[model samples]
Target: MAIFVHYLSILLISAVIFLLLRAYRLRRLRLPPGNLGLPFVGETLQLISAYKTENPEPFIDERAKRHGSVFTTHVFGEPTVFSADPETNRFILQNEGKLFECSYPGSISNLLGKHSLLLMKGNLHKRMHSLTMSFANSSIIKDQLLVDIDRLIRLNLDSWTDRILLMEAAKKVKRNNKSLVGLGPSRLSSESKMALLITFELAVKQLMSFDPGEWSESLRKQYVLVIEGFFTVPLPLFSATYRRAIKARREVAEALSKIVKERREEYEKGERKNDMLGALLGGEWEEDQLSNEQIVDFMVALLVAGYETTSTIMTLAVKFLTQTPLALAQLKVSCWKMSGTDFKGKNHRTVVKLLDDVIDTSLPW
Candidate 1:
């Protein structure tokens, strides 16, 4: 019986190898050129390298030059297409709603819950968008979110006089902003502040794992595990039995729940907040609208979406300053100019220009 089992294993291994080779040969014959790595794993290693190579854009552009605008490559286990041609990109980016629907990871609904409008499709998005218009207005933004944003910025700027570590500074900057704007109030009790900070850090860590570079297969698996807990169905259920998605999924949910509860109370008492949570709470939905758990999930999704992008841009700005001395000097100069600028139309455009120039330079190709 044992001898028979050993032969069975050998046959199974041979079949798998044969299938992989067949796929490789077929792709080579027809598909676009690419650095196809190992059979199943492919260039996943390169996509997930620990020590990222500098000038990632050129690395991608170089590949595009060799392999046209639209090419196929296997990263990890999935076949992904890189599109850069003007017409194709315009179609994908502008018409993601019409031509194509986003396939956000199933894990997203797992963590953020099913009720988030971000997860909502089609008419649902249009419906919620109608409500969003009221809160998205300039007056509402200035009153609720921007004031907190400036307050957080001033706090961060005051925290440093001469020197600070850029990455660490960027972190504190995110925390300060999250607490002030995302958390509904600048001043929260110790419990709420710690929860917000810890949860925010965990969520960001999971999301930021994917930097553009070569990724190792092992690292990819573990990294996915770290971030996978919040999946629509815990990833483990798909792989083996059940496994929880660590605490990130739960912590974010809890923090969101607290925020929603607080906002509801405040709104009940006649205090309006600026963040998306306020928009969501104030919006009209169907008879059920959303449950508290689901609302927490939506808030978690929003927090990750809104906050991470802002923090990343700030991080990119700091990284840019490291290379360019003139840029660093300009950041200081810009800060000073912002302080002197009045809150009026003419001054606003200049303030915007200063920000725009810095941002445009800092952007990655």
Candidate 2:
């Protein structure tokens, strides 16, 4: 009975949409030139169905072939355009003006917090981007961050750790290195390390809600819960979980407030530091213009985005090298051959440059 009602509701809505689309103001949409009609179920089934077979590359290739380098279509009830051309990508990324604006589906915005630079628009987006680039840019990364990565590799191997699950072992090594580099010499225990892993898991689940993937029916059904209430919904059985996390962060708040107060004092005495929180609370942002909630939202967004790509790259290096034993051995030897001073010295970029060359030459992609 419910299934019958679902189909009936869909047909009714589609008819109404089709009629409205043919109305004078929306007449052009009735003749919209793009992918052919997908019917009441829309393109959701086609997308998820394609993912069921492990590889969706062929489907994407077919669409690209039919549509050329840049073309448009409808998916998940929205108009989507695809571009595989480098020039088109460069244009979208590099040439930004009033004409083009970035936006995501309303569903996604409801999940991720507000003011995230990834989801920001126009002037607000530009502001957050400049503020974040202060910390993310390579030029500002500490020399110790690079060296500690090498030390982390050695320490992980030295732990005697019996032949471990390669995935878990890889994560352990990557976690130590990322934390040290990102947090400026913060010491963390094994448990703290696992917290980072859990955070990434939650974040990936957040990204996957509308990511067009095939999973068990169970996972797909859970998407509704995950996407709708990431911030607002508190887990009932989890025992005041969100509240506790909020309470715990007050300590971090006091610390930030102290730092902000000190920075003001220092400015009165003529001094400055370029730390992320400092730059955010910098005079240009105007203390009154920034709310505490906004600061926390920005910090949480940074922490989530910062760790994901770093861990993925670290895992990529391990996974790629493992498949090519000779390359793995070469990397180990090369890393050792570069004495500790290599990065700080004239050949500072040499290690990353060599890795880039290795990635270009060796990656199966």
Candidate 3:
């Protein structure tokens, strides 16, 4: 018993010394003050919880109070510095290329592709941005896109009967409508709502010149997988989300490569479509057109950008119109004016203004 106790005492002394040495070494590194939670996950859950709250500002405020304007914390598997200082943010932005390169978490970078606009840097970023803007220029938007947007909006608005948002309702269960919650009889079934959103997604997909055919369904499924895996803890190989995302990304890349090849062949044969993809390829090769990978990334960016947000916006707009009869009446008046010759003056500027007002009113934020 005496021998065992002696060995245990030695082991405890060694552990204490090791911990002290580690603490001293860490202090020497001058890392800012804050907790670096568990391995892998770090403070991700806390960060997520902060944003999920009704009043999220308190999360940052509480942290700032505890650990000055700038502090270090492990978040999303990275040792990140959270700064509430204005100067630090401005300095970082101004020194983006020289001092620091813009970056995101591994999950985002891996999912968005290395060549994506969000991931690109220096001249590559400039070229991609310029290319995208050229395709989405004022002329294209005014002549082609505005008409598509108007037509799509009108169609969606016309086919609106059941107007309860299932996800939102689930968050705050105040109703027992079986149909609205996908339980019983309803005008707009859950499947139909999904189909409608898919149709809207295809309308947005047209901005990239992808025909709303078989590929649309495949792309939509992949999109859901990618988005689901985007911000999740990336265990790579071991994680289901990570694996799904990787598979989806590969499938997306393959599909896009096939489309690119077909489009290129079409362009070569003198059959140029009037979509963004067509615009990108139709122009003469000035400084070398985008590669298949780059094109795919651009299309993914645009499709992801427009898909859910537009669907949610339209859904909320319909909901707001139903709840607020006065707003609905005003919107009806605007729509009536928009369809008349009087609103057609000044290149339909009046109609556009009224529509914008109605949209602004409908949107919560």
Candidate 4:
């Protein structure tokens, strides 16, 4: 029994020595300090859990505390190096082509398409960025898209009143035999909340000039599905979120392709429209025009960029406004000062007119 115990102790010590030796050899090149967690999954679950929290700083904070500003970890099933140092991050971004090429997670690249502007690198990326930026510049917004956005916002707000059953939008003012209608809801309710979401969707639709009859709602649905799984694991298992996302991505590509075909017919007939898609198809870029697939990818990228972010901001802004009285009061005061209206109006045209007035009167600088 004593001899058996002695051999067991020797085996344990040998295993420990072997592991230490392996670790040292692995770090012989002086890699950043951090744990890789486990094989295959690595620290993906931990990263997801940390980001799921309201305050995600602690995940990095704890690591930075132990391993310094620059460290390594396995996240999203990739061996990743995280730099908390701003200068280092800037250096990496500025020297992207030289030091490291731009890349995305497998899930995102798969869902957004390998040809997406976000995933592209080198001279091709620069050309794509330039083309897209030309369509989204301040001059274009002021001249064309802003007018469309304002119109859509008014229409969406008007439609909202009809959809909501739980909120009263206007009050009756009676003077003797005459009845006068006062504008606006007294407070935010469940109905207004629903209206806000629809307004955002409508705004995105009109801004992008997606065909209102068929493609708008279907495309929106597919885009939403793709977005919901953009950060999920890129597993191809049956009924997986990633699988659904890939399917939705293909559907979106099909829809965009159809639209591109229709637009081509419209261009042939000399019917030029005032939307991003129309501009892209009609614009004169003699040598470097985008192919149909590239245009579709760009449109998808643009839609994903604008839709999710704008909706999220509106949702969070409404939430915080309702929860924070002081902030709400400041917003009301600022809006009134900027526009000279209290935003209490039942007529969509009236609200739009007020906005136009504000824009007309504002200083250019």
Off by over 4 Å in 3: 1-31, 49-61, 85-100, 157-159, 162-204, 211-214, 284-287, 308-328, 340-348, 359-364
Instruction: Report model 3's TM-score to 2 decimal places.
Output: 0.72
Clashing pairs in 4: none
Q: Write the per-residue lDDT of candidate 4 for residues 1-365, one digit (tens) a residue.
A: 99999999999898778657747765895779987775546677677666554456788888889999998887765667889999999999998899888787776777777678788887888876786667666354434444455455556667667564321321111111110011112323443434334543554454456524455767666776787566555556633766788889999899888888887788779987666777677675435566788778877777776654454344344443444566557656655654633333333345556545433332221
lDDT of 2 by residue, 249-307 (tens): 44433543454556556755767554565556565676455655566556545544545
At residue 264, give the lDDT of candidate 3. 82
TM-score for each candidate, following the candidate numbering: 0.59, 0.55, 0.72, 0.67
Candidate 1, residues 1-365, lDDT tens digits: the string is 99999999999999788668767776777876666555555554455441133333654676789888877776534556778688988888888877888755454455456777678777776776576566456564534333334544554455455655554554454343322221222443332333333334333322222222233222233323334342222345353311544444555555446656776788769886545565565646434455677566555555455443554455555556555778778878878767854434665556557768778866752
Query: lDDT score, residue 193, model 3?
Result: 56
Question: Which stretches of candidate 4 lie above 4 Å from their native place?
Answer: 1-30, 93-100, 138-141, 158-208, 211-214, 286-288, 316-365
Local accuracy by lDDT, each model: 0.53, 0.50, 0.65, 0.62
User: In terms of lDDT, which candidate is strongest?
Assistant: 3
What lDDT, from 0 to 1, does candidate 2 have? 0.50
By summed lDDT, the worst window of 10 consecutive residues in model 1 runs over 204-213
Ranking by lDDT: 3, 4, 1, 2
Kindly list the per-residue Cα lDDT of model 3 for residues 22-59, writing each as its tens digit: 55865797988976665557677677666544455776
Candidate 3 global Cα RMSD: 7.0
- Structure candidate 2, residue pairs in collision: none
